[model samples]
Target: MNYTLRTALQGLWHDKWLNLLCTLTIATSLFLVSLASVAYINIKTISAKLPDRFSITVFLNEDLEEERIKAIISQVQKHKSVKKLKYISREQGLADLRLSLGDADYVLEGIEGNPLPPSLEIGVTRRAVSGDGVGRLVRD
Candidate 1:
């Protein structure tokens, strides 16, 4: 056993550069594998949370009458999967755009009028986002 140990040590010393290269290669490969695993896990976690944030935006014609808009809202509210429904007027949409734009809101000043259309923002239950519930709601 002593002789075997001595011979192994001598061999290692003779091929020090080769042994060092092999060790570095193995360590780098392990590090990359761990990094990939962490990234995959984080991506999966983020994707799972997406359903909670899922929403649908339905744009309405600029000429739609108030009664017609109310009727549409009532119909959309009848759906069981709908968690919330918000109607945004053209003015409100512009304000929201300005808020989102922050310092760049001055760029919108060049536009003659509120080009943004009135729309319905619909939020669905988490279960609805997981399957065909959103599709059925859209079709209706």
Candidate 2:
């Protein structure tokens, strides 16, 4: 007999089928949206990882002193937008080349005295790997 807010809500609660339908519809919508959000985030993370795949070869002068190389590397590290720098010694490069050219005797023979240069593979942060940023880094 009481027509209070509680009593009115109790009437809606009696419509079990209708309430269940609404609940399922809302849950389904939420699940779809959440899945889309996760996919979008995955795409973004993969994009960031892609930058690590991009590399810049910093060729060292054949006779560059170790001190000079270290000094340049320090400056490169200080760059605000650099994410990571990986150094590859000449021996490592030669080894990698040999591994890649397995069974190619001609390719192996043609390379002499570790012609490959010691270099750093630079991976720029998401904000700095663009064409313009690469040019600026090379220029500076």
Error of 1 at 56 (Å): 1.3
17, model 1: CA deviation in Å?
1.7
Question: Candidate 1 at residue 126, lDDT?
Answer: 85
Per-residue lDDT of model 2, residues 1-140, tens digit only: 56798887887889878989999999999999999999999999998688767768788877988998889899998987778988788899888878887888467675458788888888887667799988888877
State the lDDT at 113 in candidate 1: 92
Q: In candidate 1, what are the lDDT values of residues 1-140, reduced to their tens digit?
A: 99999999999999999999999999999999999999999999999999888999999999999999999999999998899999999999999999999999999988999999999999998888955887888888
Backbone N/Cα/C clashes per model = 0, 0
Best candidate according to TM-score: 1
Error of 2 at 119 (Å): 0.8
Model 1 residue pairs with clashes = none
Candidate 2 residue pairs in clash (backbone atoms < 3 Å): none
